[model samples]
Target: MSNLIPDPISNVFKSLAIAVSLLVSLVAAPPAQALEPIPVPIDIEALDITSSIDLHREAGNRLQVSTAPGADGIVRRIEVPSRDGTNTNWAVFSLANTSDEQIDRLIVAPNYKLVGSALFWPDLGSSRIAAITPSQGIAPERQKSLEADVFLVTLDPGSIVTFVAELTTPNLPEIRIWEPDVYEETINAYTLYRGIILGISGLLALFLTILFVVKGTVMFPATAALAWSVLAYLCIDFGFWGMVFKLEGGGSQLARACAEVMLAASLIIFLYAYLNLNRWNIHYSHLALTTLILILGLLGVAVWDPSIAAGIARLALAVIGILGFVTIAVLAFQHYDRAILLIPTWCLLIAWLIGAGMTVTGYIANDIVQPALGGGLVLIVLLIGFTVMQHAFAGGAIAQGLISDIERKALALTGAGDIIWDWDIDRDRIYTGNEVEDLLNLKRGSLEGPARDWLDVLHPQDRDRFRATLDAVIDQRRGKVMQTFRLRSEDGHFRWFRLRARPIIGSDGEVIRCVGTLLDVTEERTAEERLLHDAVHDNLTGLPNRELFVDRLRTSVVRSKAEETAKPTILVLNLDRFKQVNDSIGLSAGDSILLTVARRLGRLIGQQDTLGRLSGDQYGLVLLSEQEPDRIVALADSLRKAVRAPITFGDREIFLTCSVGIAFF
Candidate 1:
């Protein structure tokens, strides 16, 4: 038997198929006997209707309700005559005998403002006996159900009667009847499901709105706007707004319509930013303009005629939505970063649009359409929110990197003891880092001086020159400048500093700002000065050597000739016993004697005179003269006496003499 299993499996499948067919036949078979209908209670006292002896009559078949005098959209009463030959306002329910028993407590529901009502009768001639009206007041959640607002009536197994309803204001003249338990169950179940959907959508909207607030992303706000419009539309259509807020009339419609316009505007804005629409080859400007115009038109309609505005807004948004879907599809194919996110979002939007359009156009019921719309809108809102946050994080990451780089550069500058500065040429403002005070050796707040006063802290002699240098960089078309100058610090001591700057040029080739570094060069300048002095001054006697002496003489001679003054005089003095003294003692002793003689001779000169060592054991002097040979003789005699008086060297008393020869030009 096991070896024949393959053939057995085929036989078993045939048997299972026959069993399934039998089950289907049994499930689909007609009932053998009719069941009795359950009789439910219809509480007549709940109707709360007061009847009149004669019904109020209006001339026309259709009634038009308007606001009363001195009231803002408030109408007290309305009388609607029957459209047919019947001379009464009647609500008729046609029932069939599906079961064997009567339907006792069948509820009839209508849409109306239920505050003040006239009466409900079984028939025109019958006395008002028993009717069922809403037990609860303004139930928004319940309004989402098929059995939200209703009146209960008793009917036979098979009967058709025209029920008369006298009213203050007439609503759309259509009604539905259902069994009490079925009505309650359906209402409760539908309310629960619809409430959940609405809640999810509302929460999604709130989440997206928060994202928009946090990230300032257009997508979040746009998605939220669309969600709000859909939510409001559902609320208005299902009478949820009236139930929740106890508000009625055109005001609710206006709010819903306004939400629609906002939805359109928000979508346009989001698409523009997300898709970079302006940069696209095809101009979206006209589309944007058209959207704006439509939104404006919707707004005008909402204010002037709110009843029709909601429909117009829905139609406009649907058209815009289709266009947006196409645009987003194109963008996605082009591989835009956010377009991938929008593709799924647009698909959900399509579902929402189809569901909403079907409901609005009366193709489907509110229960089916609302859940579909709510779910689709929730997904759309969440997708947009996620994309927005993703972009925000990416942008934040790049910004953080740039900020970190800037911070590192600043730290490096601080560590290197460099002062970074910026000078706004047009504004005449100077900005500097904290390192400025440290580099400039300035007191804590001294750096806050005005731009013009920046040069005030410079050394008085260098101030004009520094200003000239800086101006050359700014006004003289110099692009980059590097110069050294002395700046006076807070302690009143001048320190050398080097300023290096590069101009920030504007588009018109004008310097807009100058960014630079200021470095303390006091140590460098001091070292340079020492090296320069060592190069031109005598090392042993600390007197100007031949190089410096000749330079001064040349300068003086040129100046004297230019001024027509007296010619300068140059005198060379040779130490007579300098070599004999060196041979007698030592080189050290000889050097000491030469130093002593140089000092004695240096005191004979005036401020306008020059004294220098021309060479080993040879000295020179320069003086200004008015061509008095006698004056020259007297000066020469003074030098000879001074040099001849020099004596001591260590423990020895040495006498030194020099031969002086004077020359004049």
Candidate 2:
């Protein structure tokens, strides 16, 4: 009992000795090896400090400094897991400087497009946080001029400092530690590559705009809009917009979201027109239009909340991809050649979208994602540009060939003494070949004026008719036109012309011009008149034949009955012994004697009377006079006396007698 109850001073001394031993043991242990000091100018990837780093997830967006070390959450691998938007990710790491000189380094979060804000805190310095964002104002501690979240870290020689990084981002953060030279080199390379892409995109947009102006096609403008939208997105993503416009807080993010939404909307519009959906499938076209409207509606949401709008934009992009694929498939099934050509391009675009989406959603690392996306964008542009140009210019090529062919044909026609004329209805101008002046026997350049000048050259009798025919052709949109009119030559002679024209219809299905050939038909008209005259007259004798005589008698009879005017009489005279004369003498001599008898009979009738040759030896007369019975007998006797006169035919005397029969109407 006396041993158990020890003395108070000895017990106190023993406890002190034990505490001193424990303290001495702790002091002698060499600080647990001080976590291998990181050398200066180190490669973050080679060092692979992620395994030794610690991560702490906070529940809210607010920044909170924790005095406790992040021992509970240590990252065991190089890959950093993604976090949701509701939480903040804090990465804790030790940056120990084992070098002889003080070293300054940059800790960069390269995925600036995804990161909202990044805060850096070093335990060695005054308890202060250096925060950086894409839209932050410039400061010495943060590299705001760059498009990345960059912070400067300085470490003294033989110093080990623990750092905490507060990252507010949905995607997995990529942190890189680099010396100034290496970072500058990397940034320069990135800038060069991005600049090339943006330049190409801008040029493409301008080209598409020019195409729209020239072609006046909906697809061209839609493609131009899409290209411009893509350019805007690239500008925003590459930090060019930030330099130009100081968009703070959510402004930059909202603009990016709106650009994405516009891009999707423009893409839909372009696809609609490019695929000719309205002409092919009306219902599908309506659906695409509705989808476009919805995509545009996302802008409103983007104005209110960019993150939500960005998510919707991604969804819209996915929907558009599906819709485009289905549309192309449907068109391909219908044997649309353009849709078939777009299949591989669309597939490539879909693959690129999937890869980009994965990168954005943190499923994939961002190390190669940005460059790949940029390269993929350029490739898609080239592929689509090639495809569109192949089809768009194909029709133009065909039309150019056709125009050349037409020009060749027109030249041949002009060489053949025909005039090729183009009537511009819109301007009311007439363009004729140079040969027109020579053909019309007019001064040079006489017909190079307005359409009225062309009309002035036409005969008065034909001008109105020609105008009417042209107007009808234009109004009715007739494919072919044929008209015969007379044009006045410089000699004041009217010459007939035959116009053969074809209407040149525009894309709007209106007749814009009439292209035709003018062929002079004056000789043809003269020959036709001669042939008509020959049909009515006798060949040997310059007198009307029996058919003409009958036609005149019918007309006279109808006039006499209708008007109760002077009556008409018809006299048929037959030459006696004509066949005997033809047998005695030759046929030529008989013909000569008949001509002499016809001349004698022509002197006996009045000017109003018509004398016609009835047969080889017979003659008929239609007298439009009031004749009584005795007058008729007298006329018949006079005709007989005229025929009874003897005539000399080729040194032979020929005598012929005529028997006359008269009829009255």
Candidate 3:
């Protein structure tokens, strides 16, 4: 029955069995926890002490101490040897107030500081405790002080006593005998040093803020953030805020945390903004925000539990700092063309980080973080100044390029005989970059008014059509259009122009403006007219040829047929022996004789008559008159006598004669 159960029941049974097995294993296991003290102490012997006060070398120098904590969990209570030669000894020293002034304080301190270490003296009162090695990191002012990393004891005049300290390390540190004048000088120097750093960084931040506001550029904002971060760092590191603002306890720690977070976040922002990472790698931007959040979280932990958070913060900062440097370096390398100016900045930042790493790992005893950070910050300010100069140069170059392009286009337009014009439909105005007097033979500003002003200049035959075409363009009924028409100028002469216009559409798909160009086609129109004239008229004598003469004769015949009192007459005249004149002289002489005969006949003919060149030397004349043969005979005689007149060719003279024939209808 069990084997025949469904698969679901068996699967549930197997899962439950596995869960039971895991629970059994966990219950059987021992709880894992730390067995050592909160801060594990290192024991030191007095025989290892290398240096001490001259008077106490024999008695107090042979002391042994343990860095482990006392009953209160604070590092104090130095234990002395019970027997004559036991495991440990204590350092006993005496001080005599020889001067008239009373000695108020004494400082017992190490010559150098170590991380995760502190020194305590119960004999000096509770508030007089000092860190031998500051776990919270050294401030810029404290790092430079001669007596800051020491324990202080208060005493009256002429008081002699012995002091004991838990040796935090095997190394013996110096004991500072504090004097009124020396302590005053040390405090003053520390303050002055810190004030200079703060002032310089503050000014730089202000300068960068001004630049950001003026330039309205992303680079300036990012760089300004960097400068402000430096100011924050100097404030936190030098304890200047503690003096001025009195931010104590959690407030000071929190302020320091915020400053550190700003420092890291600013570096990330500066790198991405300098490179314009939104155009390149958006993922890096997201990563930068994530890392910043992580840094903030770690800092929050420091406010609650500093011991655990300090280790984590250091490790996290080291990793993040290295990663940030590498990421920016890689991006800079990839975008070296645009990031060339940032090379000095990133290089100095990496070097500063290396110095900080050295300080963290105990290789460097002195503080390098201050100088490294200060130098890097100054470099960033200089880079911003240079970037501004480069931007101005680039702007100038772009403007010059635009000017050259306009000049080049202007030359091309002049060569193409195109004059540009702009029309503002909303204003009902037309503007043209052309000489009104040269193009339209008008006064200089005649066409500078409204659209109606230009329309008024159009020839009467084209004025209505021009208005219609222009309306079509403004209405966007046509994408672009070209039309040729005659325009009457100021001198009453008409000139042909081809106007081409295109409508410019707004975002709403309505035409807001029209840009047009005009081409003067007067010479072109004249050539076309001459071509039409040559096809129908004789080229040499400038008289209507056979085609035109026949058309006129046909019209006359039609008219005469319709009218009862009117008749049509035609006359043909041929120059007799005209070939002899050309053969004797030249074709030029023959042309001159023909011209003379045509001119004479032109004078004799009435305004209603038509005269044309029929052939090489023959001419024809038609008239609308009575169909009387005597009238035709008289007109033919007149034409014959007209052709027999004398003609002159240059200096040569010749007489021309013609045979005439007449017909009546």
Candidate 4:
């Protein structure tokens, strides 16, 4: 180290060091200090009043409104109607606006029923009018403007009144209100969008239906068709789109009614096509027929001159919609395929159903009955479209690829399939995909338990073997094995499966995990058994024929010779008059005699002895040393006598006999 500099240089250097240290401290301390009072912008969403009120129109009077200036000489236009025919006379308009810095108290409105009450506060909702319905009170020093609907009598025979309210913001924040017209326009836009969507989805559904019918797409088309029908039903609001436009009057209401009828008809058609409700689905067809009948009745009522028909139709449509909803739910639950839809599906269903109900109720209550499921429909269609796209491109989309794999696996094992699972003895948990539940008909809620407990599902005969095999696999530590065994399906049906698994080893060459897949082998096993039967047995008679008989004879002889060094008695047999039986009674009768003779021979043989068909009507038996050939001959004679007795096939009797041949080794 060098010596310190003189006073001026040392002082300057010390100051610089202190300055650097202070700067560094300032920089380092800021982030922590600043984090102390973190600013969090909480998004706020508030709900307020929205009700449809009829504004009655007066003819030859243009509806008008005016407001007197305040004490501060501030006079703004209070809302008034542009003179259209309606029952709504006036309405009080209010909005809320506040800065984070200050608490703003809003003094607003006598929200009471008044004749000629209509206000124009389209600005109120646009400003996100956070309205607090304050009681009649004195105005505060810093008061906000309170707008109300007013009517100025004017020159028209049939003029409708609309109230306009405005909150003129003077350098203050603004919030919006849910304006009726704006909402209407928005809903109309959404409905239009829904129309376009319906067009595309309808075409898509039609295409799929045709393709699936031609291609025999099995289950996928049905699921896809149902999904499409749901989309259309939701967009159509079960036909409530008709009522909203009908509010404009003239042919509009009729158009709305016709639209409803068409939608209902279309809905029935969709159900018919989608569910194939015509032929085998008798119950669904009946239900659908009833729904169509109701639709016809509703249509008749709606067209029964003037408004009463419409009212009745509206009510009927609501009822029909509810019924259809129940039907759809039952079908979906039964199918449970793509059946288990997420929230959007429920939202769409409820929106249309609710809209239908509201249209009916609103009509009876004499309120402005615009009961279209507009926004909700928009939300559903967009979501459903997105969902469809996501599903269609599932394999390509990274986020959805994994999900689709799981879904497909679950779907594949949905019915009439077996799921065989294996667990590593070392690993505490079992590994199987979602397919396990579908295969086993298990609720996701019911799948957890000890691994060995699953042994209960195995057939009693196979359980011991299964357990032994598992133990062996575990003991061996790193072997791959494929095993066939019997297990119980969810429906209590027994099924065979072939399961295979292997252990994944760690870097230390120790088995860390095990993985496996299961395949249902019941059909294959049955086919294999059939092949074995075909190969070994005579087709006409149910007996162990030559190949198997000879094999059994050789096995018994070898076993007998090696074990006790005893001579095994062998009795060879032939039907004594089989040729005569065949010539007299025909081959079918001869077959019956052979069957009867085989049964007799089986009864005559002891439990330990073996018997088999040697060839044609010839047979053989192997007995232990204790059994004699003479007794076997007697047994063969008894079989011949039994065959000589009356044999029945259809309505005929026949007689037959077999020649006995004896041998000893």
Query: How do all models score by TM-score?
Result: 0.41, 0.50, 0.40, 0.41
Whole-model lDDT per candidate = 0.62, 0.71, 0.61, 0.50
Per-residue alpha-carbon lDDT of model 2 for 194-256, expressed as tens digits?
Answer: 899899988988887877676666767777887888888888777788778876446677777
Candidates arranged by lDDT, highest first: 2, 1, 3, 4
Per-residue C-alpha lDDT of model 3 across residues 277-342, encoded as one tens digit per residue:
677778877876787677667666656654344455445545655675576567667765446665
Instruction: Choose the strongest candidate by TM-score.
Output: 2
lDDT of 1 by residue, 1-665 (tens): 46556888889999999999999987885323211222222332122112211132442344322212211222223233443434333322122333446554443444421111111210101112122111112211222322134554555443322233433232322244455676578657767877876787678678767766665545456656756765675565445776777554455546656765676666677777666687786568677867777677778877886646655656677887898888888888889767777787778778777766665544664434545555566567667766666766666423322345676787677678777767888877777755667655777656554566777887778777777776887786556878887877667878887888898889888888888888878999999989999899998999999999999899889988899876889999998967888899999978887788788877877778888999999998888743588988898888888877748766777776789998887
Candidate 3 versus truth, CA RMSD in Å, comes to 22.4
Q: Which segments of model 3 are wrong by more than 4 Å?
A: 1-160, 164-175, 306-317, 332-335, 367-665
Q: Which is the better candidate, 2 or 4, if ranked by TM-score?
A: 2
Q: How accurate is candidate 1 locally (lDDT)?
A: 0.62
Backbone clash count, each prediction separately:
1, 0, 4, 57
Give the C-alpha lDDT of model 4.
0.50
Pairs of residues at least 3 apart in sequence or in different chains that clash in candidate 1: 78-168
Candidate 4, run of 10 with poorest lDDT: 33-42
